[model samples]
Structure formats: structure tokens, C-alpha cells
Target: MAELPIEIALDDERATQRLGQDLALALRPGDCLALRGDLGAGKSTLARALIRCIAADPGLEVPSPTFTLVQSYDLRIPIAHFDLYRIADPDELVELGLDEALGDGAVLIEWPEHAGDALPSGRILIEIDEGPEDSRKVRLNGPDQAMQRIRRSLAIRAFLGAAGHDDADRQFLQGDASTRTYEAVTTAGGERLILMDAPKRLIGPVLRDGKRYAQIAHVAEDIRPFVAIGSFLRDNGFRAPEILARDLDTGFLLLEDLGRGGILDDQGLPVTARWEAAIDCLVALHRTDVPRHITIQDGTAHTIPPFDREAMLIEVDLYLSWYLPHKLGAEPSPRLREKFHAGWNGLIDRLENASKSLVLRDFHSPNILWQADRAGIERIGLIDFQDAMIGPAAYDVASLVQDARVAVEPVLRDRLVARYEHARRRDPDFDPVPFREALAIMECQRATKILGIFVRLKKRDGKPGYLRHLPRIEAYLRRTLAHPVLHPLHDCYTEAGITPSES
Candidate 1:
């Protein structure tokens, strides 16, 4: 479907540059933007702003390519700025490496009309016209997909302006396995905040019980869960990022910057002191009698979902669904699949009587920030707990000790677990043996799920980076399966050809 042209009024040069910044956030590799305007129409100014924003350096030198014809930047996403005004023939576009430029990164072409029919039809067309009294009107039209991205970027810019961050600069921070994206916004006052740009969650094909995978897993569908849970954590004395500004319906949030300190050292190895502190943080949290139903300061209510049998079972099924086929080159037989579920069903049943607390489903190194200057449990910054559930506290402990992204050594892992166990022992109701069994069970469950997830990330999402950690997860899974309680499922995994080798 063709997208209608979107028009914006730029009242000043800053607004023109802000459009460039929005374009920076919207465009990706293989994108080409053709700027259409007469001389002195601010095309070069917009291009410069985009290049500098992508470079994450406000002072970057972006000389016009009028004479050079093309100037390339090796920034986060490499970009090529082109001036087609000097082109004597249409064939000159090929010689200038337009295809090569679009191959590795994006392109911005000024005087695109001079290139004749050389431009790709998929390119985004932006036209700028001077208006009365130092104003300009810009119209942008592109492919439906590109238009969607452009619209989202414009919405985010408008949201930021409404939140009083109109002059803030945005730099891409990172993206996770989910659809959400994060940006580091530097306000005009030099304060850095995280701009969480999570649109409404995508609903996959209904898999079971008329629910999608996210719904079954209790994954948050919007920013409301994040706001409610973050507020709850802060009220209970944790360092979750404070919500500075929010547009809940739009899923745009300006959150307090929790700093870049993490539990890992410079070499990506676990820092013992930080790990110990994280254990203490979890200990304190587990000790607290947290209610499942929490009302935020805004009077919004959220009920923490239970990490129930169906959720855990479906999560483990990822191993059979993705990993088994990827490993064995075929689907498991119906008999073997049923056996896999039967084993996990029993394990999940045991959790019904296990110790319950708020489970930060992803309580690992990636989500944990080490705030060196803060005191006690507050030093551990809890940044990613929107999917918090009321479930066995042992699940979170297992997630931390068997850190998914970073390989925590055996000695360190045992020490951290022991520290947590020792601290939890202070609770009169804490039973050490049952907790140890639950930890082993949770370890097997998480590792099994991740084994499939890593492969799925490569096969489904085109992300091969996570596959490198497959061996690490296998090692963790192998260690966990050795526990006597997991023996029933060990054979099921072995038959499926994903049973981690003892070696």
C-alpha cells in the first residue's frame, strides 16, 4: 500500500535539524533518503544534523559534499552523503558507488533530480519548501514500511517536546530480543536519561487457549507494567529507574539514567564484589513481604502474574520445538514430545509448594547495574523487571548464578548461591533443602529454554550473535541435569539429541 505524504512545519533551523535527528532514528541500513529542495532550503543542514546525531557527537564536522560528490561516515550505522548536482551523466551515479553505499549503510542524496532514473524506487522522498517569515514546510513520502518508521519517529519527537525535552539529543543505546528500543537522551541541561520507545507488543498467531506467546508468558504488552512495577520497586527501596515523564498510551518513557556500571568488570568477567552485592540485594527483596497487587503513585493498579505451570511448560517446549529440530534435523516423535512435557510437568508441580516472592524473571548480569557509590541493596540497580511475577524466588537466584550472557565460574556461582542461601536462612520459614532442589530445577528450566531461544534468535530473528553463547548454556544445562531431581527429564533430552554432554 502506498503511504500518504506526511507534512511538517519547521518554524526554525532547530526544527529543521530536529527533523534530521528524527530521520537518524528512523533510517537503517539499505535505506536511501532523497532530499528535494531548491538552493538554501536547509537540506545540507538537515543532513549534517543526521550525520552528527548518528555519530553521537554533537561537534562532528560534516562538510557539504558539493565538491567531493560523496562523503562517507564510519559511524554507528555508516552513512554516505551525496551531492548529485555535479553529475554530468546518469551513469556517474554507479561510478560513485551508490549501490555499495546502500549495501553497507544508508545514503542521503541532495539534488537527487540530477541523478535522473538512477535512484532506487524504494527510497524515501523528502521535499522542503521555504514558507513566509523564516519558516519551512517539509513533506515526506516513502514505502509503507518506511512511512511507519517515519511516523513513529515523529511521534517520539512530539512526545519528547511535550515532556520538555524538545532540545534533547538522542543516541541509540541498545535493543534487546524484544521489539522495544532504548535511547540515551541528553537534555539541554546535560542530564542523561533513558528514552524507552516500546510500542504496543506485537501479537503472534494464537498458539494456545486463544493467547499469544507473550500473553501466556505474562510478558508486558505496554509500558504500564513497567511504570507500575518500577514505581513499586522504588517505593520499596530499590534503584529501578525513576519515571521522569511518560505517555503511557504511546509507550514513550523518559526514565532516570541508572549509569553504566554493571556487575561485570572491564574484561566481561564477573566482579566478585558486585556479584556479592547483587546477592544481598535479592536477599533483601526476598525477605520483604511484597504484595502481588500493587498500586502505583498514579493510582494505576497492576496484579503481578504467576509464573504458572502452563508458562514454564511452554517455555521448556522451546527446546523441543526449536532446539531439537535444529540439533537433530527433524521434529521429535509425538511420543518423545509427550515424555518431555511429562518430565517438566512433574518438576513444575513441585514449585507449587516452593518459597514464593517477586521473581524478576531476568535477574541476571545484563539487567543488574552496580552502583558503586550507593549503600547496601540500593547499590544494585534493577533496570529490567517489567515482567516481574509472583513465583519461586529460587528462579531469580538461578538466573543470576547461571548468568546467561556472561559465564560465571563454578566457584563464583557456588559462592554466590551460598551467600544468598545464608542470607535467606535468617527467614524463619526458609527451608534450605527444598530451596536447593528448586534452584537446580529452575536452572535446568531456564537453561533448557535458553538453548532453544538462542537457536530461535538465529533462525527466526537473523541474530547469530546469541548463538556464540550456546556452548556456555549447554555447559550450564549439563551441570544442572546432573541433579537427581532432574534425572527423569535427562533421558528425555538425551533422546532428543540436545542433552548437553558431560564433557
Candidate 2:
């Protein structure tokens, strides 16, 4: 945390000022600048000058992010400058995905006082004040390494400058399966809008196209079930955020932004409480009925293909090829591979009827955002749900218990399975044998899909970071199947030559 740079008096731009050309060259990658000033404070003037100098395009004037909110440049390095003075809302900054650009390189942020904590550190904070005549006082803040250079460059000058509830927009307690969630949003008019960014093309709650399980229902008319689900949760007094607007064409939703902290990140809590809240969020959804008139027929008819045995096997085979051989260092004999597939296929059939529950298909640690301030129902927020489906109750439980990103304690996994079963209507006397079977199979199902997805994200989309989590998926598969409960599956993995990291 370097200190902000000190100010040095400077005359009018024509007299004694740090020219933008020099400033541009001085500002290198990884620079985060804070520009402070009053109205007509010349902040924009300075920024524009810097932009031209950095861009080396003499006649170009960068448009303000005021209306666009953010203008990105494809220079030698990406430079994003934000003007918050006219920024309609604060949290909207997160939607801009500036966080992604934060570490990529330097960012020129102006009227930053309006953006607040969104600013990244390790750069300069400039303050500009209107002074007598055309002269101005500028105060600059920065790391010591750049302080003297900053002071010699742009002179620093000092300067400048949500709660709510709307019922029409419905929100769901996002606990599991919803990914990269938008918690809450504050509109420029001071309206508190809850937002979720679900691009049906990517991953989220509602799936679109033929990808109902992997995408979102972008069209409002088509999203009735999703909205109905949200409304029901909200009306039932479940703590879910509201969806304010949806760009169905693009699958982006402007919903309320829930605050930080969720069960996903809390490692200090007891296993019992963690499992309890997770089961509760699921039970609430199962109890949530679509309006009597809006029969499951319509929802069911238009529903994307069920996550059936075929789909489950398709997912499992990916692990067999991509994950197993790579980790185990050898391919399984043909007989073992055949048996593994057949056994997994049998397990998927068993999964089809674990007392059907509204499965949040990706319910897991990373999908949950827990809140510390919450008392009861408001505790765990769900996400990545656009993939919701009518799958076995154990499927969601397995997704949570055998998380791909983070491992849940085995104690917690056992407790949640019990809690979920007790909340079931038909399976009160359900055997853990079958449930545990479903859990291992689903864990196998989940890990395989994610491994393929991660490989795709990296090889195709050029996002390699997701690969780091593959080992966790591998570890879960080995553990879940290692139990005497799943020895059949475990032996199959070994006979199939999976995971040299033998149990």
C-alpha cells in the first residue's frame, strides 16, 4: 500500500504542467490512477491528453465512460479508464468486468471517488483542485518507487466527491449451482436493483437453445418458470435477490446484488451448520410449486432434455479419457473400461428416481455465497442455477458434497444427505446405499463434465486457470468411491486403470 503522491503547484496547462506525452510514457503497465477534482476540474482534459499521448494518435479524444461507463483500449497493453462522475451506479462497475482487467495492466480511473472500493491498488491517485486563475493544485499519491516521478509529472490536486426491496422482481436464495453471480445493484436513481449475469451461451441458472442445462432461458416469455421459481422463493420468505431486467437477447440479467460472504468461503463454521443450511435451501425449492395453472406440463414440455443416463454416461466417459488416463498414467484394459461404463450407466438409471427434486444441477461450494449478517433463511445465497432441472434429490446433494472446486468435509456430506432425505416426501426410509451410490455416481458424473469443460475452456477459450481445480475433482472421485459403500465403483476405477493415486 504505497502512499498517494504529493502535490506540486502547477500553472495553467500552457504554463507549467506535466505534458500528457511524458505522462503517458511514465505510466507503464499495472498502474492504477485515482484522479480527484471539482466540477470543470480539468481531470478529463488531463486524461484525454494522456490517452492521446499513450495511444500516439494525435487527433483522437477518448470518449468518457460516463455514458458508456467504460472504454477499453487495445494498446500494447489493455488500458481501461473509468469516469464515475456520471456513472449511473456503483456496483455496475463489477458488471463491466473491470476486475478481470485489474491485473492485466494499467488502468486510468477518473472521478474515482464515485467508484469507491472498486479501485485496485499499486498505482497513482491524483487530486485536482480549481485554483486562482487558470492555475491548479494537483496532489498525487503513489508507491514510493513512482512518487518522485509522479510528482514531477502530473501535479496532484485535492477534490471531490443503497437499501431497498421491490417485489415485482423476484430473487432466489442462490446457494448452489449458480456461478460468477451478481449479488445486488444500485441504479443511478437510487433504486436498489438485484442483478444476476446469466448469459445463456455460457453457464448459469436458465439454459437456452438446446443447452438448457448449461445456459439460461434468455427470453422473458420463455423464462416464466425461472421467474416463477424466483417469485415463489421470494413470496415464501426465502432470501433471494430480485431480477430487475433481462436482456434476453444476450442472456444478461440486471438483478439485485447480494452482499459478500457465503457458505462457500466460510471455512471456520462447523460442518453441521453448513450441511443444515444447504439442505434447507434445496428443500425450500422442492416445496416451491409453479402456479397451479402453470402446470409442470408446460414447464415439462418445453424443458430441455433430462440429465438422463445417456447424458450422464456422455459426461462420465470424458473423465475416463481426459482425467483418468492422464492422472493414472495408463489406460484401463478393454474389459474394465466396458464394465466401468456399464456400471456407471446402471447407476444413472438408479439416479433417475431418487424421489425427483428440483435439482440445482451444479450445487457446490463455489456456487454458494454465504452471508454473515443473515439470521436464518437469508443465510446461503444460491447461484449458477440456469441449469436447474428435475433430477434425483441426491444429484444436487452430491454436487454440493462432492464439489469440483473445493472438497466438503465428509462429516458435512453425511449430515446433508440425512437432512435432505428427512425433507423428502417419498424417500423417508430411503437407503443410504442407493443415496451413497447416487452420490458416487454423480461425483463421477460431475468431475468428468467439469474436466471436459475445463479442458475446453483452456484449449478453446484460452482460459487455462480452470485446470488447477481438476485435481480436486480427481480427489473427490477417489474418496467417494473408496468407501465400502462404493467399493464396487472404486474397484471398477482401478480395474479400469483410473487414478494411479489409489485409495
Candidate 3:
């Protein structure tokens, strides 16, 4: 196994810019170049040349879209060049329409500051610097494995004079998260890929010990409890994009890309069409034979510590801190706070003890993908499952039914919950009354946790937009609280300064 040698050299500015221009010809759909440099540092010069080479329209003039923001051109490949010098805010990027450019084609930008949080992980971060006299120094950083597959493609095309696709021009994809990404592999050949960041620094150690930590094919029998459900889902007719490549040392995983079109909340499609697939996927997950091999033994996410009791308490705290404060404009008194905690703790115990199964903690709309044209997901994806534990079967069901990011029709929710229960047991003493009660409990459990997570995203992760979903999640919590089963807990939340949030 030989690693490709990276050449480090101080090339003249002219040569470096020329090399960039040449690289432009290699661009194709799904490629991005982040031009990094100070003012008048030649970032624009290289971007301009790359655009010209890509558009093949010598008439295509490169104008800095300082005021207009982003200039899109129909080139040999679609090219979007954005200038963010004037844009002080990332939200402005959405208004300027750079969101549409990140994934469609090759994007060359003079200033990417406007891209803000929406930059794709598949972007190439190009650092351009002013070198001596007329020279510049250029660097290329990639997010994809930078597989020899890509470098090899270049080498083979060079070795044999055959050309089907031009590598000179490329397109790029960016998401709304600050995952800091760039990819080198081409998905046109039908490869699936997913990029995940270590959500917390606590994950670094686990990735090294040889568990299926997304970064490696390595499996941890010690951590087998965490994977039983995932392995079960894969064994069933359901498909989880198999782990393709991993570097456990770095905690980086290369997954099968489910495609950009996978829907969490794409509004272009009808709700009936989307949830129809979602419901089926949930059914499959719930129907699977839950592994009894789960060990609540020492050093697991489920031993009732940070990932469970303490972690769950942390979630309840989110509700106490943000949603309640935002709606009430202040924190409740200590007595009221204790009441909320006691009620919340009781709720956790009820769910944690009620029929333990593999609970995909974050199984919801954003984590789901509509892979087919009809009912049921062509492939159900499980993200944010690192916090998984053998717990209530209704945990994920409550997640899908009471999604906070968007509205889920009550009709759909009712039908889906019924489906999940049916799949779990043909007639395990069906009780709609208690079921609804359980659902409300679960939804509150989720909302309480998300309130904390969203606040954490803003307070700690530097992502403020997540706060937007707070009100909606608060509304979901309210609905669940209104149920007769959850009335006591709901009262506790209200007493704790959680305003009656419904929207």
C-alpha cells in the first residue's frame, strides 16, 4: 500500500495560477474551489482564469459580483463565482442565492465568507498567496479520501489519449453545517458517501478501539450492544449504506452517498408522498428482531450515565433553559425547577422501562431519506444514532410522528404510529388511549432534549439558526403535554416558566 507523494514546492505565481487554470479544465459537476487570500492577493485572478477555461466562452468576462453578490455562467460546465467581500453576514448568502450554486456545478468564488455555514464538505479549499514579484503560491485541500481513484483517473487519462468526460471542470456540493469538508471522489460512478464530524471530542477514543465507528470496517464486539439494531436493519431487506472505507485513527468515514435528492424536508414533493415512504421505513425498523444480546454492562452509552440518565437530564435542562426562558422571558424559581426535573425524570423512567428495544435516538425526518417513487423509503438511513441504546420501541416512532423541524399531519402521524405498533406485535393488547399517552410522553422527552441541543448548537457549537426550530419543537412539546397522560408533566413544565408555546 503506497501513499501518493504530495509535492511541496515554492512555485512562481505565474506557474501556480497557470496550474489552477489547468485544474479548472479538470472540473466537472460537483466540484468546488474555495479561494483563500487577503485583498488583492490573486484569489480573483485564479478564479477568473478557471472560469474562462471552464465556460469555453472566451466571451465570458469575469466581473467581480461585489454588489450583485454571485454571478452564474453557463460554461463548458456550469460555473458560479461568488464574492463575499461586501456580505458581512452568512444569512445574506441565502438571500444572494449562493445556496443554489454549491451543488449544481463548478463554483469559483472570489470571497466565500458569504457562503457562511452552507459550504459543502466536498469543496476544495484553495489557498492562494502572493509569492515573490509575479508569482503566487497555490495549495489544494480535499475532504474526500482524495482516493488514488481520482488521481489515478487523471493518470490513466494521461497515459491513454481517450476522453469521455473532461476532468477540467467540476461542480461542488455544500451543506448547511460547518463540518469543514471537501471531497475528491466522483459519485457519477454510483458510489455512496457520507461525511460525519466527531459530534464531541469524547468520540476520539472510541473510534480507535476497533468498533464500527463509521470510520472503519472494524467492529467492536465490546460495543456490540450499540450495533445490534444497525446490524439487524442491514440483515433485513432494509439497506444501510455499507461502510466503504474508514481511517479509525482519524475518525473519518467514507460512506455510500444516498444522493443529494434524499429528502428530510424538501418542499418540492407532496407530504403524502414523502411520509408514505417514511412510514414504511419506520415499520421496517420497528419490525426487525431486536437483539437480546444487548449488554447494559460496564462502559456503554446506555449504562444510565451521560448517554442515559445524565444525558437525558441534560436534555430536560434544555427545556428548562431555552424554551422556557424564551417563552417565559426568565427562568422559573428553584422550586418550580425541581418540579420539572422530578416529572421529567419520572417520564424517562416510564419510557426507559417500557419494552426496551433498539432505539435509534434521532430517527426522524432529517435523518430519513425518500429513496423511491412510492410508499416506504427505498433505503432508511440512521444518522445521529451514535447515542443509540436498547430502549423503548416507540422512541423512534415518537420522533417521526412529532417532528419539530416541520409539520407532520395528524392523519399521517396516527397512521404511522399504528403501523409501527402493528409491526412490533400483531395484537399485543392494543390500547389507543395508552398508546397516545405513551406517544405524548415520548414527544415531550424528545422536545426537552432538543431544546438543550438547539441551545447547545447556538451557545456552544456557534450555530444560531438551529434556534429557529426551538419554537416549533416547543409547540410539539405543548401538544404532547396537552394529552391526558402527560397533563401532570405538562403542568410541571408550565410551572417551570415553560410558556404555553404553540405555533
Candidate 4:
């Protein structure tokens, strides 16, 4: 069924521009937004504001395209502004490159009626009309999906406004493998903050006793886990972002901006000192006694879940469920799947005697920020830890040393592992034998799961960028399989025709 049209009242020119800014944040490439209104209905004003906001330049000159008919900006998500009032023929849309404009980026078309049926179907149509006093009424008609995004953008604007940041400018930061989106917000006073727009989303098919894949995997269904974990980290002297303002029910959070310095150098290679600091942060974190139950700001308790055997098995199943199917173009036979499961079960069984700690599931380069001016582990800023679990400390150690996003060379990888082991050995009871064995097993498990995840990210999530890391993760898997404990998994890989290259 089609969605009903939405009507918004803009009290003045400022509100009209605010709506434009909101739309700017919501736009994606290939989007066409048609503006229908009489002259002086604030169409041009809204377009100009939107273009300027997307460019992140308040003073950007967005001249009226009334005479030229079309104006293009080479900003992020390239924009084409068109005023079709002067067009003599519908075929002129081709000459004006409307198709090409939309192929590369989004387009804002004014006097769209002049183009007749030349406008693309499914384009977001906005009708601006005169209203009481100096106000304008805007009616938006579009696909239900697009309208949902528009509603979200408007809600974010309202969220900012309620936080006394009505005048703030929002710039797109990044979106990860999940449904969450982030924005870099600059307040009127020039204070910078990060906005986490994480609306609750249920993921995947109902698998196993009426639970979804995310539920079985212990993935966060809402922003509450993030709030609880971040608060716990902050209280424990970790540099997790300070929540400046929050609307937990709405899944909007305004957080203190952690600086952009990362462990990777300008050349995209790991820096030794910075990487050491990150390791130190992990060591310090593991040494602390983290409680299973954390109280959020709302006085609600969040109990951290353990990365139990079931979760591990479900995660390992990703290899059989996604990666192997993609590689072979068919699901493996039941016997092979059982062998694969048995291999992983045997490996995880060894971790039963491993040291348990707060495992930051993603502790690699992308999530670790470097704060040079600070001393000790305080120099390390933790950004992504919402999916943290109570698991083997070795799991996090392996995650870092094998850093999936970038190549952590064999020498550096070994040195880092040794560094972590050395730091933990301060306690006389700490045993290196079990820890090393657990690290190898965890590395293999993480690498195997990621092979499926990266493939799934490409095939299922429309993100092909992750595919580039497959070879590296496979190489890490091979390296770990050299350990005697993972020999059975190696044989399983060989049988499945995914024999990791001997390193």
C-alpha cells in the first residue's frame, strides 16, 4: 500500500531552511527531489539552505538557477540543482543531463511540472504553499520507505532542537554494517559533538526457538546497551564518549566528540607507539573488575551477557551458513556441516578454562582512537564497544593482533601478543601456555566468522567494500590453524576446499 502524504508547517523562512537541512542529512545518491510551488513559495530558499548544509559551508554561494536552468556542485554526494521553468520542450530534460545528474548524485528540480512526465517516477515530491502570516505549508509525497527516512531526519532535527542545539549543523559521519547512523554536530558556539542515530531494528529471520539471528548472537536491539556500556566504561576511567544529552526512548544521543586521531598513520599503516597504547588500554581494562550488571542513567539495570558456547557456535555457523555457500555457490552437505561444527566446538571447548574478561568484540584499528596529548591508556579512546561480552580475554587480544581492517604483519602481530601476555604475567598465577593456546583458537574463530560476515556484508547488506578484507582474514585463519589445537579445523577447511594458504 502507498503511504499517505505528510504535511509539515514551517513557521517562517528559518523553519523552511531547517527542513532543508534535515532533508540534506537524509539524502542518498540517485535521489531526485521535485519541488512544486508558485514563485516565492520558499523553494529556492530551501534548496540553497540544503546545498549549503550538505557542503558544510554556511557561506557557500548557491546562485539561483533560474536563467541557467541547471547548476551542479561537486560536493560530497554531488548535487544538481535544476530550475525547469524556462524549458521549451520535455526533450530538453535530456539536453540538460537530468538522467546523468541523477546517475551520479541527487537532484533538486524546481518547476518540475514544466518537464511533464520527464521527471523520474518515485521521486520525492514536495509541494510548498502559502500559509497563515509569513509561514509556509509543505506537503511531502513519496514512497513509504523514503517518507520513513524523511520522518527520521525531521525527528533528529527535533532532537537537536530539544537539546538546545537547534542552531547546530549536522554533517554525515559514517554508517557501519548495522542500521545505526552517526552525525558530526557543530553547535552555534562551535562546540563539536557526535550524534548517534540508532533506531531500534530487529534483524534476520526467526531462527531457533522463535529468536532472530541477532537475538541468538546477543546483538544490541536498541541504544540502551550502548548507553549502559559507555557509562560503565566512563565510570571505570576509560575514555568512552561522555553522553552530553540523550533521549533513550527515541534512540538519539548527543555525545562528546572523541578526537579523530587513529592508530593508523597517514599512510594507513599501524604506528608502533599508538598501537602499544591501545594494547595497554586493553590490558588495563582486563585488569579491572567489570560487573555483569550496569545501571544506566535511567536507573535501569543492563546485565551484560556472556559469550557462551551457544553464541560461539551460532557465530561459527556463519562460516557454513554464508561464506561456504557463497564460495561453493551451494550449501555444503549435512555431513560436512557437522564436521565443521564439531571442529569449532572442540576449539571453543578449550576456552572453557581460559581467563574471562570484558571482551570488546571490536577492538581493532577502526574503533581505537589515539589521543596523543593524554598519558598512559587514557590516550586510547574507545568508540565501538556496544556489543562487548563477557568472554575470553584472549578473544580481544587475538582481535587486535589480527586486526581485520588492516594488515598487522606477522612480526608486529607476534610482538603485540607477547606484549599483552607480558603485561598480564605481572600476576604470578597467570599461565602463558593456556593463554597462547586460547589466543590461537580465538584468532581462528574470529577469522572464520569474519570470512562469512564480510561475504554476508557484501551479498546481503549491499556493502561490497568489506570484500577487500577477505584475503587478509583468510591469511590470519591459516596462521592460527598452524597451532596443533586447530588442526581439526584445518582439516575441515581443507575438505571444504577452503584450505587456508600455508603461511
**TM-scores of all predicted structures:** 0.96, 0.56, 0.60, 0.94
Q: Rate the local accuracy (lDDT) of all candidates.
A: 0.89, 0.59, 0.57, 0.88
* The candidate that achieves the highest lDDT relative to the unseen native structure: 1
Error of 2 at 60 (Å): 24
Ranking of all candidate structures by their TM-score, best first: 1, 4, 3, 2
Off by over 4 Å in 1: 132-134, 297-299, 495-503
Candidate 3 residues 50-169, lDDT tens each? 776555443467888777778898765778888878877778767866557755767776666556767777667767676667666656666544423244323422322222222323
- Summarize candidate 4's per-residue lDDT along 87-168 as a digit string, tens digits: 9999999999999999999999999999999988879999999887769999999988888888889899888999999978
- Name the better of 1 and 2 by TM-score: 1
- Please rank every candidate by lDDT, starting with the best: 1, 4, 2, 3
Candidate 1 structure lDDT: 0.89
The Cα RMSD of model 1 versus the native structure comes to 1.8
Model 2, 1-503: lDDT tens digits are 65555655667863222344335645667777777788777777777777765565646768877777678887755688777777667787788777766667667777888876777666577788888888888777677876755443222111000122221212222321233223232333555554443333343344233554332222123344455555545677766667655544333455555655556434544345755887787776665553332223234433423556555665666556555555567765687678777777666666665555566676766657675677666677764454455566667777777776666666776777777767664645456567666666666667656776776556555567778977676676666665444454666656534443334
Candidate whose TM-score is highest: 1
Clashing residue pairs found in predicted model 4 = none
In TM-score terms, candidate 1 sits at: 0.96
